[model samples]
Target: MRPARALIDLDALRHNYRLARRLGGGKALAVIKADAYGHGAVRCAQALEGEADGFAVAFLEEALALREAGIAAPILLLEGVLAADELPLVAEHDLWMVVHAPWQVEALARATLPRPLDVWLKLDSGMHRVGIDAEAYATTWQRLRALPQVGGLVKMTHFSRADEPDHERTREQIDTFAAVTAGLPGETSLCNSPALLAWPQARGDWARAGLMLYGASPFAHGHAAGAQLQPVMTLESQVIAVRDLPAGEPVGYGGTFVAPRPTRVGVVAMGYADGYPQFAATGTPVAIDGRPGRLIGRVSMDMLTVDLTDHPDAGVGSRVELWGRQVAATEVVARSQTSAYRLLCGVKRVPLVSVGG
Candidate 1:
């Protein structure tokens, strides 16, 4: 078998969920959308089965998959029903929905279900993504509350700048959500991973832990002081070849990197085809035999070259970690001008091995 495989540490996943719960001080929904951000939703959900207060997904299909996996915990459809026809499936699966648009409100009002649906009313405080305007929030809330089909209601709004701790936008959003939903007869959820970590005040009735639940820091500035999260997925591969190139010799496509001195380059068995970032430039961090190394040239479809001069002992069969404990996904992506979320969710074609559930 190819030595390129992703090792998923389920223990770290559960630990992160527990940390999210501790920080939120309330019910926390493990955001398992995008196939649990490429960590495998079914496996991650099963790992957090009895631990997480609930699970949140981008759409109804994801919720259905979790339900099929026998996950009994509440599954929330973050985007809610896409069309009126999906209402029956929402009710049939007893899924919680996030009513973000007026059309969704209209659909719910027009349809009669076997059971009342629990809904989270979303307000577009500042994100301007997919939410009702603050001006329409109160009226929408009242209208949804009056609907016999609506069983429980929760006020929710997403933060656009919560990752930037110094930014005033998150604070403004929090205040706006408060002002719009004040005295409202329902629970509230405004914190995504970043808000829940940086702004304690943003934590409401339900905290949605997305990237953090996969054991990565949500802040661009790096891990918070007290919030130390263990990495859950370690992307590893073996060194398939090692070459000693003479000075002035070029490496990889485009000759992006030329040896300034006699350099030892180790070819790893994983690449963009396996979801490794293609634009990752020279000097991106990697680990050879658990020691530090730097990506030396352009990433190829099935291979990437790493500077193995410092680790002269590293050769064929040596372990190479693309990202995890030693080289963080956050660090690797930062060098590549991308986000950890993309790296995590973009992983495809690579086999996964789960450990320590």
Candidate 2:
């Protein structure tokens, strides 16, 4: 059986971390959340352990998982606690929390803890997603800080349009973040990946890098050299079958892609089940037999077919790169009409061999 594989390049990951450090020019937290964007949290974190200032995850469970894995690095919980009960664990594990709501503030004020907690005050600069609005930020910060459980405070905000380098929204968010925490006595974190790469001004006291570490550009149309990144994960599969199709013969379920001419096709031993995207329509690119080809059918549950007419030498058992070094995830994301964040996080139920071959 063909084993669908994700070859994670630790060197690439480290290089990206270095890039973030150079560009951030300050403390940099690797956002190893989402299982390090489906690259495996424990492995990715362990690889970055010595070099990174800290690792940032979405919740306490993720932090605890890393801790249980012998990961001794400091962890920042970007989403903070969901329930009042999670507070003790947060304190016990020394996990930094991003207190964004009144309930959390109240809970922190109530929780009895042995050690003070570091807090990253999340201000709703513009996204208006999960953060406490700027107007109420100070009061909330003051309340959270008043708790004997609180240690140092840090201000943070997520960008709504940093991915679009030309969008004025990033500037607006920066201004709002600045205006809210102008003289506040705390460190500030503003940049995500795009900000860290493109908006030099967004690099504050710290930057939380997410997509960039996996070698995906946060800005649209940004290239590897332009963003100064390295490709971290390369997903590959093998062809299990090959056949010829007559002109106009429909391929795959629902006739998603009809052969334009007498075309050769190779069925790869990978599909949605192996983390290959399901909605990836025909014409999505793939590397077949070490050659570039196009996916020619609807992505199936167990496998997907690719056009091999362009590569006459392609055959069964040939290696196929769904997305990776040569066939960048950015390229896949563009063809799939999705983001690298989704693509990387979407990888599931597949054996990802980290440290590369």
Candidate 3:
């Protein structure tokens, strides 16, 4: 064994979902897209199946996987049906779809399904990535409402700056959404993880909980509204080798880190291939046998070196925590100039162990 593994705490995942529901002030859709943000979709969904109001994924295949896994909870497709052909599966699986574009509206109008499908009409409040413009929203709503195959219709919008509490753009988007869907019927969903945590007023009939459900804060500044959500995944490995390098010796490819003094360096069995950031600068945090240490060199394909000068007892076979309760994924990404989401989703090849469901 490589001694490298990701320990997923399902209890922490459940707690985070509950926290989202508590703060959302309405039904909470646990967003499990991107394979539950790399925590293993089926496993996480199974753990949350009992308590989640619904499970949300980005595609129809993801929903199908959950269905195949025997997940009976309502599954919402965040990206909705990519093609008209998927509408059948949507109805068959009783999945909720986010009708963002005009094509989806037309598709729904054209399709003759065995049963009516639930849909969320996405409004392009601010984010230009998806959804229809405000002007097209009401008309699209009318079109979808007229469709015989459309069942429950929910008004939905995504936040462009929900993570930035101080930003005014989120407020603008919320106002735009309210104004556009003012007289329209059906439930509404506007809050993402950040909005659910920081902007209580953004909550509607349904809130989408994504990153926060995994216990990593979505905010760029602090924890999830300082909520006591536990981290779900702990990336762990062990020191495979140790060396005492004298001053003037360089370490790793490009010698990015030179020993300022005689230093004890410990080689960890995890690296970029295992989801560790490749450009993680020197001084990035790591935990050795539960004690703090700093990364000392560039992350290699299969190993990373950590400065263990302060830990005289740390050597080969010592436990190392890449990120977890001790070193948050947030902190690690901050130093790496990336994000916790990328780090989490980048995890592959490493074995995953689920715990505390």
Candidate 4:
């Protein structure tokens, strides 16, 4: 065995979900898209199946996988039907979907289905990515409302900068959403993980919990509410080899890090192949035998070196934590010049072990 594995704390997952529901001030759809941000969708869904209000995925296939796995909770297709041809499958699986574009609406109007499907009308409040324009929102809503396929409708929007708690754009988007859907008849779902944590005023009838549910703070800096999140994935490995290198010796590829002094470099059995960031700069945090350490040099595909000069007792076979409770994934993400979502979802080639469910 490689001695590299990701410890998944399902209890922490449940805690984060409850926290999202509490802070968002409504029922929440646990966003499990991208395989629960790469935590393994079926397993994550199973962990939350009992308590989750519902689950949301990026597309219909993801919803179908959940359905095949026997997840009976309401599943929403965030991206909705691709070509209206997916509508039959959507209805057959009792799936909900977000009708974001005009084409989606037209498709809904054209499709005859087994049963009426719950539809979420996404408004392009500020983010220009998708959704109906403000001017056309009401008309689009009317079109969808008149459709025999739509059983229920929910007003939805995405925040581009909710992670920045003090940003004015979030307020602007909130106002825009409120104004556009003022008289519309349906439940509202606006807040994502960051909005649910930072903008109370942006909270709607349902919150989409994503990154926060993985116990990683969405904000770049410390936040009062973000502090409550408990990291669910602990990426751990072991020191495979130890080197006592003299000063000025370069380590790893590109000679990126040179020993400032006599250094004890511990080779960890985890790397980019296992989803560790290849470009993670020197000084990225690592934990060795429960002691603080720093990653050194460029990361290799199968191994990464860590500074163990401070830990005289640390050597080969010492436990190493790439990121988890001890070394927060947020810190690793910040140092790696990546996002928590990417880092977590990028994890591969490593076995996942569930615990504390």
For this target, which candidate reaches the highest lDDT against the unseen true structure? 4
The predicted structure with the larger TM-score, 1 or 2, is 1
Task: Tell me the TM-score of model 2.
Answer: 0.96
Where is model 4 poorest over a 10-residue stretch in terms of lDDT?
105-114
RMSD of 1: 1.0
Give all candidates' CA lDDT scores: 0.92, 0.87, 0.91, 0.94
- How far does residue 21 in candidate 2 sit from its true spot (Å)? 1.2
User: Residue-wise lDDT of candidate 1 within 1-357, one digit each (tens)?
Assistant: 889999999999998899889899899999999999999999999999887889999998999999998998999999999999999999999999999999999999999799999999999999999999988999999999999999999999999998899999999999999999988877889989898789998989899999988888877776562257889999999999999999999999999999999999999999999999999999999988988889998999999999988897889999999999898988888888789899999898998899995
Q: What is the C-alpha RMSD of each candidate to the true structure, in Å?
A: 1.0, 1.6, 1.0, 0.9
Q: What is the C-alpha local distance difference test score of candidate 1?
A: 0.92
Name the candidate, 2 or 4, with the larger TM-score value.
4
Q: Show the colliding residue pairs in model 2.
A: none
- How many clashes in each structure? 0, 0, 0, 0
Report how far off residue 196 is in candidate 2 (Å): 0.7
Q: Candidate 3 — which pairs collide?
A: none
The TM-scores of all predictions, comma-separated, are 0.98, 0.96, 0.98, 0.98
Which pairs of residues collide in model 1?
none
lDDT per residue (tens digit) for residues 219-242 in model 4: 999999999999999999999999
Global local distance difference test of model 4 = 0.94
- Candidates 2 and 3 compared: the better one by TM-score is 3
Tell me the lDDT of candidate 3: 0.91
- In the range 42-160, model 3's lDDT, one tens digit per residue, is 99999988889999999999999999999999999989999999999899888999989888888888898999998898999999999999998898888888889998899999998
